[model samples]
Target: MHAKLGLFFLFLSLAAIAPLHAAEPAPPTANATDAASGAPTDAATEAATEAQSSANAGAQIPDTLEQRLLACAACHGKQGEGIAKSEYYPRLAGKPAGYLYNQLRNFQEQRREVPIMTYMVAYMSDDYLREIAAHYARLQPPYPAPAGGYPEQELARGEALVRKGDADKNIPACSACHGKSLTGMEPTIPGLIGLNREYIVAQLGAWKTGHRHGAQPDCMSQIASRLSPRDVAAVSAYLTTQRATADSMPALARSARLPIDCGVVPGASSADPELGIAVPEASGESFGKDGKDSKEPGS
Candidate 1:
């Protein structure tokens, strides 16, 4: 009876030990292969499965417009307010949607040539470009303070040129197209405020050098060509000193025609009574065809 009890206990011990051995993971040996065929061992297959799972987990980021546009915030601010004192990047916030759209098209078409900009828009469709433009146009963050340190003479000249043009030089006042307050006119023209002098100068220089182009009969190119180096400097200086206010929002569509024909502005190239477009005023007085002085905000 004692011998029989010892054998039964030994059998129970063997059973427990067998399961423990079976539960332990098998060590993979060199050139290990499946017993049925010459295929990779289960250990290799398990490792591959684990790697694939990790890859799938890494790809789980949400695909959204905001996520795609995170790259833009690197150069332009999160709110589309360009970097302060950056010469190349300008504020996109609160700009007219049409103007912003045209610029994206320009970059895509190589009419404007910033290498990075060109690359960014290379594969974008027109609708996608419009969406991007609209996104930035809707942003209205507070602007950084205007930079100063320009000479008084230059500032005065700039003010004169901006408010009242040099008739003898055939230079129309900037306000004629930019609005009396120097806030941009709606649908096309961009605001001149909140930009650094260097950026403004660089743009004018680009136009002069034929490095930039807009729609045919590009009025900016014409205007830029006519400006002397000193004139450009004066205008940039004055524009950089002005502060943006609550009334600084873009002006409504022009009641009077633009001082010059701009391809970007709808119906600006010709007078279409149906479109309510009028002829440009040589004097840059912002007067309508009916001889009414069409005043703008803050005028």
Candidate 2:
């Protein structure tokens, strides 16, 4: 009876140990193989694993600055070059950062009125505006060819105004602030060349009508207000015909004083928001030719 009982206990112990041994098979000596031919297997699984690893590696990186500013490109061009449909959206590349920053701020502040721009920049901070300005300022993309098909007399009249302002009317030359090259001055002022004729006219119109504004004592407002419709048309026509310089660099200093007290003097347009030289906020106005939102990527 004792021997039979001991045998039964031995059987139970072996059964428990059997499951433990089965649960942990021997470690793989090599990759799994086909039993029939002893050929290596798992080719599909190995390939899948490598593909997954590559995918994970690519996901670890971040997007570029160009990728981040898709909205700007929608109005501006892919390279911040100018584009136009019925409405002309100016090229943003190669402008002074301060100029760009100030324009964006004006739009945000309701000081420079534009409804779409206002909405676009409503949530942005000053630093963010600066970053955007800097990004475009650094990009010196090539300018598009001048689309000139206007009368010679009109273009000539435009050239005269840009080169020599109507002194009798107290309007300084466009080159007075825009530099002899009309490429723009450093710190803030913008170049007049490389813009569309309609955009140029519209912006001047804005300044004249007080629809667009700048820092207090805005020179452009005074200047534009002084310009007749003919003067605006002539100036716009001549400016668009000129090409940008190869350098495309904003000047570090002005060659001459601003000629009048329009608030673009030295130290006037500081980084401080108090200057109010920021953006032209959207004014709930339509920019499309048919009185709707302008088309994307060059409106």
Candidate 3:
């Protein structure tokens, strides 16, 4: 029994000394790789994967107004420059803010009847709409090349209509309200340049068919109603043939009273009978100036 006890003590001393003399092999970790072999550890691999995923997600959904408006780029363009191949979607860039704002409200209020526009803005607040309008209005992109290829006679007729009114038909010149440059008049009217011919034709037709509406007087509707199909074509063709330049910006303000009363246009009043100019009577209102020679006002 003495020898056995001595042996046990010896064994215990040996065990203790064994650990002091040499290290034991470590247990493998849950996430481990051979560092000497330069292989990536499980934790490192997972971290890299997570980082890549975050990068991809960030790319897809960046926080910016321009990025948020990507859906609009599908039709209108990235900067509201408009889609060149499409005649249906008109350019929104560089248009008057008030005009753009009005159109947005019109879509929201159902005064305008474009399903896509109405749907896009259905849930947007007035302030949101105004922001969108301002964004597009501030952008001034390069205009597309003027479209051509109309017969000379057709262009001539269009020019006559634009430059001088048809006295016999009591039709006022387009420039009378659109400005002499045909760019537009400030505060409301939109520039005619860079517009697609087909788009112009369609809008005029919409006005004529009562598919579109404006404010009380609805002068555009009245004017469109008086235009024949042929006249519409000529005007669109002529407009497309014209180009816009730096000087083609909308006029700051009207120098004189509008030849016709346009309810949407602030301060537009009836023509003076003293000048023998006839204008359409305002809706629920008559001409203030009295004259002996009376004529019909067509658009």
lDDT of each: 0.60, 0.57, 0.57
Clash totals for all candidate models: 0, 21, 0
Q: Flag the better candidate by lDDT, 2 or 3.
A: 3
Error of 3 at 182 (Å): 1.4
Better of 1 and 2 by TM-score: 1
lDDT of 2 by residue, 1-299 (tens): 32233223223322332122111111122121111112211332233343346446865312444434544554466668855543345788998776677677677777655555665667666556667787988888887776688789988888888877787998877776677788876556787778766667767776776677766567778888788877777787898888776566766542343465444333322232212222111221111112222111110
The number of residue pairs in model 2 that clash at the backbone is: 21
Candidate maximizing TM-score:
1
TM-score of 3: 0.69
Candidate No. with top lDDT: 1
Q: For model 1, give the 10-residue run with minimal summed lDDT.
A: 21-30
Rank by lDDT, descending? Answer: 1, 3, 2
**Per-residue lDDT of candidate 1, residues 1-299 (tens digit):** 32233223223322332122111111121121101122322332343343346446876434445544544554465677775421234688888666777787787777775655665666666666667777987888887787789899999999988888788788878877777667786666788998766667767777777777877658788887778878888898899888996336776664456677765553444433322322333222222233222121011
Model 3 lDDT tens row, 187-221: 56778888877667767766776666776678887
- Model 1 gets an lDDT of 0.60
Residue pairs with clashing backbones, model 3: none
